[model samples]
Target: MSFNIALSGLNAAQKDLDVTSNNIANVNTVGFKESRAEFVDVYAASLLASGKTKVGDGVLTADVAQQFSQGSIQFTNNALDLAVTGNGFFATVPELGSLETSYTRAGQFKLNADNFVVNSQGGHLLGFPVNPDGSSASVSLSTAEPIRIPTASGAPTKTSEVDVRMNLPAGDSYIAGAPGNFDPDDPLTFNNSTSVTIFDSLGDSHVMTYFFVKDDPNTNPNEWMLFAAVDGKPINLVDDSTVPPSATGIIGGNVSGPLQPTGGVGGARLTFNASGDFISQIPTLADGGIITEDFTNHLPNGADILQRVQIDFNLDPTGPNPNEPTQFASNFEVTALNQDGLAVGRLTGIDIGTDGLVRATYSNGTSQPLSRIAMVNFANEQGLTQIGNTGWKESIVSGEALAGEAGSGTFGTINSSALEQSNVNLTTELIDLISAQRNFQANSRALEVDNQLNQTILQIR
Candidate 1:
């Protein structure tokens, strides 16, 4: 009976040591959960011939239960590196040989040679696929699928309207010989300019320049005029400001200051030609201090305003700003464009969000969401059986898998450029190992003593 007890201790100790060694070995392994060897004691049972108590004997290996505690998070620069903050696991279907869905907590992923997002084993991360319009669809991937970034987002259209915001100083004086050396006649020339590269309906690029000219060199502080030109062609300004060109009359402002002197700051209206070039019409009094320029004056000046040219994609084949728009409720407006827009662009890069949303940005002023990441969870996590390579297989005990997006329900947020390390703890394992070693040594001593006693009895006999 004593020998049997010693043997049981020996077996249990060896198993415990094996568990500790395994934990220590996988300390560096990502997503590895340490396991514990459990033992059950057996009691002797005596059969009752007449009326006797029954007892069972010895101890045995009961189970090796894995600890599912989360590992400490480590930061990796790669955006594809992912980590689970809370619960749930990453699902990957093996690509080599037989196909089987495996679950893992490890999120060390990289883009494959084929440009497909994949893990070390080439298994693709599954998620909801997206359409060109940045909408998602229900789908799953067996491996990381190749991402598609459009070369040219779309063809350019006509320029409808523009918005600008800027600061123009009214510090300069209107009278030259005056105390401030004010010279309202010579308005400030607009040299501070920006260009936007816009594509024509024919897919041709045209640079547009917007010039801001301040007319009120003195009094009406914030008054300024605007000028627009495309490829150096004046498009919106008038030919002459003094004389009326057509029935539209003179678009210049009424004369304000002295008769012979060039128009002073106050009465200036903005005017431009067909090519978008602009000029300001200043009003000067004809000796009688009479207001000359009126509604016919087109070069209207106002407060210092920042100007911007924006492109409105009118998908509607119908006329501009159609009453009822297509696809989009109205029309997608891309504004605050310089010259025209970013140089004729191509798709350049892609990124994934914590919620598993994929976005693609283009060299042009265009961007779209590509997809959403999908996460799966199991009911019985402990029931999951290991399939090597830090992957797990679903067993009858694990129940069915529940799928959803990150931050939804029990799913954890996806951390970009990070990976989850193994949950194995060396500290606890070392302590457990010492206890197991002592038990093994004591069992050995007991077995040796038992054998010595048996030998003495034999010798005496």
Candidate 2:
């Protein structure tokens, strides 16, 4: 009986030593949790046995429980390295199409050849589908899917309109040849010129230049002629025969006849007030607007039909508006230029927000949500079974996983570009190791004493 008791004590001490050694070994491991060996003393007691002097039988290992304390976070250069600050685990699937789920705190992830996010073990990280606005589409665990990032966006779209707000110098002199001699190639033909690149239906770029030539200062002191051309090809606004030039050979000199309209064979005219404030636009379109222009055969190979672009002067004759262009005496400058067109862009980088939404950025300065990482919390973390690779499996003792978005409810915020280090404390493990070694030594001495007593009794007999 003494030998059995000593042997049981030895076994229990060995188990304790094993747990401590494991904790010390994984001290530097990422997402590693320390474990403790729990023991219970055994005693032989029955209904018929007297309780006055019942001797203990031995010691037995009850459970080897894992500690789920928070681990220190180490920041890394990799964006995919993630760390949780509170209670939650990163759910992953061992196989691509498997329904079985495994929970892990190890967030060292990378994109595979297929662009799917996976861990070192090739386990696919599960995440909730996200809407275009980066919001979670659903919160159920069953709806979670593997996150796959797109390498590029779809085809490009042609630019239909360009909104520009700029100030044209109010004190500039008129062109050398007036309106009839206005040419894009000659700098003296136009006072100020601005160019913008526009994309066609085939995603080809074309330079559209706008020439601002001051009108005859003697007759129209506050008027300016606007000429537009694509690749130096003048856009014909109207037939020159209908509205002939004035006696002075200038288009804006006459205020009557077919040339009465500000825009005819010449470019659109901009009229300003004496105080350098924009007053009105001439050559109004059929819709009573002077801000739009229609250009035919704009592309080199007729890649697209008529290219209609709206030149937004940003003038709102209504109340107070700061975006409107003013005729300030300052040098000609373009304040803002924007166009609604896109080109084929390659994937540049990825960003993971605090809400666990993974957004991929493209070279075209556009970002789209790829997926939202799913965070899961178990009712009983200790009840989870270890499945190696620092991962855990839900057992009967551990209730169903509660799925939710990161930073929502009790779930913790995700720290991107970081990794959660092992929770094991080296100092504490070393102390526990010493205690277990002492216990083993004491148990071995007891066994030696028992063997000596049995040998002495046999020799005396």
Best-matching candidate per lDDT: 2
- lDDT comparing candidate 2 with the true structure: 0.80
Candidates' C-alpha lDDT: 0.57, 0.80
lDDT of 1 at 200: 42
lDDT of 1: 0.57
Q: What lDDT tens digits, residue by residue, belong to model 2 across residues 288-405?
A: 2332234444566665554556566655565335665667889999887777776655788999988899998877667788899999999999999999999999998988999999
Best by TM-score: 2
Using Cα atoms with residue i matched to residue i, what is each candidate's TM-score against the true structure?
A: 0.63, 0.87
